[model samples]
Target: MRTAVVSPKGDSKFLLQMRRGGLVKVYDSCLMAGSLYKSLLVSERTTAEEVVQLVLHCYNSSDRGSKYSLYEVCPIKSYERALHSNELPLRIQQNWPSPEHFCLPPQTESGGHT
Candidate 1:
């Protein structure tokens, strides 16, 4: 395994992550809290798609990656939105007025991100 380098500004430098039948949280992206989140380093350049890949890498599985979606979640105001593949994680994070979190939750049965 390789070590992830953190920038002076504390941006995650990028490593990896994933989930099969579970969920993963990149904090400060929403209001939900759980034990699944740790510290994964991703920079301002990291995209929603790239984060999915990192999640898969960190999960050590190439299985059914499409079932997961990166979402900007805010439980307090009941706001949740799926992020575009090309959208920048940090860029979105930097624009939040209140506390929000990023989560790679499994898609709902209707093929929507939950």
Candidate 2:
């Protein structure tokens, strides 16, 4: 049996890769599905006191026993800033066409064909 090399320090980087590599829809779905519970702990909607209970419930219901739910890892303001600052490792704009010369074809031909 062989194992692939993956650095623990690159967990977030791997996740970003997964997102860009066509896994974004499902990953975002999980995030959105669990967002309501996360939103409840957002700065003003609820107090810090309720965070733990809400997180525990969210963990049980959706996190599949993993402690990766955002609440436990995100109560601190600095962590939030760090999370927001996570830059995309890959640059994509270089592959797209510029809009300056953009054009569209006619909707129909003289023969009334699409």
Candidate 3:
């Protein structure tokens, strides 16, 4: 049987971007207690950088039985690119339809909805 596993670190980069954009915050009362996972779970203010740091800390501190690594969980290079560039990613642009393609058909004298 194939069991689905849910990960808390899935969107860590996106969250960091959101925090950098001023759309979220990285620290909170809960985070001061030193529970990284709990801080991430409860606060929408955590940044991507903070998440990356937490993941790294967890991965480095874990024993041999750990299932994943920081490199496997986070896209470090992509995040770095995003931090340096202002332009949207090519994938996002491709998904967005061109405005020219949405032009309305030339209207006739009869403007009835056929």
Best by TM-score: 1
RMSD of each: 10.9, 21.2, 23.1
Q: In model 2, which runs have C-alpha deviations exceeding 4 angstroms? A: 1-45, 61-114
C-alpha local distance difference test of each model: 0.56, 0.25, 0.27
Q: Compose the digit string of candidate 3's lDDT tens values, residues 32-81.
A: 34532322231234433344345335446442212211111112332211
Better TM-score candidate (1, 2): 1
* True-structure lDDT of candidate 3: 0.27
lDDT of 2 by residue, 1-114 (tens): 233455576554322222222100001123334332232213222322233334446456443322222111222232221111122201211222442222111111121201
Q: On a 0 to 100 scale, what is the lDDT of residue 73 in model 3? A: 13
Q: TM-scores of all models? A: 0.58, 0.18, 0.21
- Full ranking by lDDT: 1, 3, 2
Candidate 3 wrong stretches, greater than 4 Å: 1-42, 61-114
- Number of clashing pairs per prediction, in order: 14, 0, 2
Tell me which of candidates 2 and 3 scores higher on TM-score. Answer: 3
